[model samples]
Target: MVEVADTAVRAGLSGPRHPADPARRREARAGYGLMSPALLLMVAVLALPLAALIVLSFWTQSGFTLDRTFTLANYWRLIAPSDREVEWMGLTFRLAYPVPAILIIKSLVMSLTATVAVILLAYPMAYFLAFRVHRNKAAWIILLTVPFWTSYLLRVFSWKVVLGYNGAINSGLMSLGIIDAPLEFLLYNPAAVTITLAHSWVSFIVLPIYVSLEKIDRSMLEAASDLGDSKWKRFRRITLPLSMPGTISAALLVFIPTVGDYVTPELVGGPGGTMIGSLVQQLFTKQNNAPLGAAVSLVMMLIIGAMVLIFLTLIGYWRMRARRAA
Candidate 1:
C-alpha cells in the first residue's frame, strides 16, 4: 500500500499533465506579454532607423537626390584612397587622405589618446575611493558626478575658456612672470581635445572601476595577507584581477563613445583637432551626402567593434592563464 502511494505521488510530480506546469506556463506567457510592448518600442525607435541607415548606405545619390538603387560606390570610395584638392584660405593643397580616411585615422588616434589619459587619471581616484575612504562615500560620489549635472555643451565651452589664449592658465602664468605672451598651443589643437575629453569622461571611467573594486571580497585580500603575501603581491594577484572586469568595462564605456565625439573636439579642437564625427556631420548635412555619411558611420562602428573584440580576447586570455596557474 505504501509503495503504491509513493508511485502515485512520484507520477503526479514527474509525469506529463503534471499539476504545476500550467501555472508556470501562464506566468511565463504573462511575462512575455508584459515585455512585448518594450520590445516593440525598441524595434520602432531603434531598429527601423538602423535598417533605414543600412539600406541607405548601399544606395547612391546624384545632385542632391538619392537614386535608391543598390550600389557599392559609397563603400568603394571609403575603401579606396583618392586624392583631393583642398583650397583652404585661397591656397590649393594636395591631401593624400580622402575625407573618410582622414576622419577615421584622426578619430582613432584622438580617441585612443583620450582613453588612455582618462583611465590613467581615473584609476587612482577609484582605487582610493573604494579602499581608502572609510566614511561619507556617497558624498564623494556626488561630488565627483557634479560635473555631469551641467550641460555637456557648457562643459566643453568651459574647457575652451580655460585653454584659450589669455585664458586662466595663460593669464595666470603671465601674471606670475613665467611667460611674456599667452600660450597659443593650449587651445585649438589635438592636445586641447585630449585634455578636454579626459576631463569630461573622468567620472564615467571612475564609476565602473569603483563598482568593480567595491565588489572585491575583503576576505580574499585578508587571506592573501595571511599567506605571507606582501601588499604589492596581494594587490597584483588579488585586487587587480578581481577589479579588471570593471576596468575593462570602464575602458569600453569611454573608448567606444569618444571615438565619435565631435562636441569636445569641435569646441577646443581647431583645424588641427578635427575628428571623424565632425566630418560625418558635414557629409550628412552640409554636403547632402547621407549615403556617404552612413558608410563612414558604419566603418567607424566596425573599427571600434574590432578594437573592443581584440581587447576582450586579450583580457580573456589573461584570465585563463591566471586561472590555470592558480
Candidate 2:
C-alpha cells in the first residue's frame, strides 16, 4: 500500500496531464455541447449584425444607390480635418467634423453626469434598504421597482407634463403666488435629459448596490467598532471598499445605455440637447446616409469600449493601492 501511494504521487508530480487524454477530450466536448445554444444565439444576434455593420461602413451611398465597391471615403470623411478651428480654454482644435465631435462630447458629458447622479442618489437608498430596513424588506424592494413597472415612454411623458412651461410645477407655483409666470427653463434642455436619465435608471442601480452592502461580513464591522473605529471610519475603510464592485457595475449599467439613448434626449432634449445617437438616427432615416451612420455607430461603440476599459483600469489601480495599504 505504501509503495502504491508513493508511485501514484510520483506519477501525479511527473508533469501536467496531456490535452489529448480521452477523459479531458470527452469533458471538453460535453462543455462545448452544453454551450452550443448560447454560442449560436450570440452569433445570430450579435456577430452577424456587427459583421454587416462593419461591411456597410466601408461602402458609400448615393442617391438611392449603395456603391458596393469598397472605399475609405466614409472613414476619411469622419477623420478628415476641416479648415475650421475652435478655441476653448486657451487651446485651439482643428475639428474634423464639428457637428459629430460636439455631439459626441455632449453625449459623454450628459451620460457621465447622469451616472454620477444615479450613484449618489442610489447609495443612500441602497444603504437604507441594506441596513435600516429589517422588516418587509422584500416589500420595500417591490415598492422601489414599482415606478419602473410602468412603460418607459409613460414615465418620460409624465416628467414632460411636470416640467413643461405650463405643466404641474408651474401651475403649482402660480397657484401659490410664488411666481407670476411659468418657468420656461424647466424642460427641453440638457438638464432635463440628465434628470430623466438619472431617475429612469436609479431603481436598477439600487438592487446591485443593496446586494453588495448586504453581503459584507458583519464580524469585520463589529471588530472595527470594538477596536475604537467610528461609524464613518468603519464604512470608509471596510464598507466602501467592499461595496465598490456593485457600485462600479451599477455605474456602467447606467452609463453605457444612456450614452446611446436617443428617445429620452429626443423627447426632452431640444435642439441644444441633441446627442450622438440622435445624429445616427437622422443619418440612417432622415438623411439616408447608412454608411456614414454605420461609421458613426462603430466609432461611438469604440469610444464607449475604450472609456469602459479606462474606468476599469482606474478602479483596478485604486483597489491595488488599497490592498497594498492594508
Candidate 3:
C-alpha cells in the first residue's frame, strides 16, 4: 500500500510535464487569460459605482461642495423624527422624519408585483415558443423585440394616451355604447403604472425563460409520456422545476429596475402611484436636500441588496433540496 501511494504521488507530480498535460495546461491558462479582461471590466464598470454609492451614503454635501467627513447623522435622520417644520400648498407640513422601513416595504411590494406579472405573462409565451411554435420563431422573436427598438419613453407615453379619458380606448368604448361616459378610474393610478411597467419588461422575462426551456431535452418529455405521465404531470414534475432558475433570474431582472424606476410611476401613477424613487427625486430636485437624498438613495440600495440576497438564498436552498431528492 505504501508503494502504491508513493507511485500515485509521483504520477500526480509529473502529470503536468507530459505532452498532453502541457497542452491542457496551456489551454486552461489561455481560457483564464481571456476571461481576465472581462473580469476587470466588470469590476470597473459595476463594482466601482456600487462602492461609490456606498461611500456617498455616508457623505454629507452642503450645496455644491462635498464634505469628506463620515458621520452617522444621515442614517440617524433616516430613522429618527426631524423637528424641522415646513409649509406646502398653504398648509404647514412637519418634517416628522422619513421612515426607511416604510419606503423599503413599498418598494418591495411594487417590485414584487411587477415581477410576478411579468413571470405570469412570460411563462405562457416562453412555453409556446419552446414547445408549440417551431417555424418563424426568429421572426416572432424579432416582432416581440421591435417595441424595444423604439424609445422607451414613447412606449410609456403611448400607454397614457390609451388610458386617457379622451384617448382611443375610451373613445372606442364610448362609441360602442359600452359606457355612458369615459371611465375616470383608468389612468393616473397604481394599476396603470404596474401594467405599463410589466408590459415594457415582458421581453426581459420571456427571453430568459425561453432560453432555459429551449435547452431542455425533448427526450425527457417523451420519456415521461412513455411512463404514462400526462401533460400537466410532466410539466409540474419536470418542466417547471427545470425552468425555476430562469424564473428566478427573470424575477431579479424585473424587480431590480422596477424598484428603482422613477419614470413609470411619475408618468402614469400621477399621485397615487408615487414610489420611493419619486420621493428621492423630490428630495434632490425640489427640496435641495442632498444629505437626505443621499441617505434615501443609500437606504434604497440596502433594501434592494437585502431583497436580492434573500432571493438568491431561497433559490440556493431550493436547488440543494432538489439535488438531494434527486
Rank ordering of all candidates by TM-score, starting from the highest? 2, 1, 3
Native-to-model Cα distance after best TM-score fit, residue 325 in candidate 1, in Å: 5.3
Model 1 TM-score? 0.86
TM-score of each prediction: 0.86, 0.90, 0.80
Q: In model 3, which regions exceed 4 Å deviation?
A: 1-48, 61-68, 81-95, 99-101, 322-326
lDDT of 2: 0.89
Stretches of model 1 off by over 4 angstroms after superposition: 1-27, 81-97
Candidate 3 colliding pairs: none
Please give the range of 10 consecutive residues that has the lowest summed lDDT in model 1: 88-97
Distance from true location, Cα of 117 in model 2, Å = 0.4
RMSD of each: 9.2, 7.3, 8.3
Best by TM-score: 2
- The true-versus-predicted C-alpha distance at residue 241 of model 3, in Å, is 0.7
* Clash pairs detected, candidate 1: none
Best by lDDT: 2
- Residues 76-122, candidate 3, lDDT per residue (tens digit)? 87676556655432544344664444555666687789889999999
lDDT (Cα) of model 3:
0.81
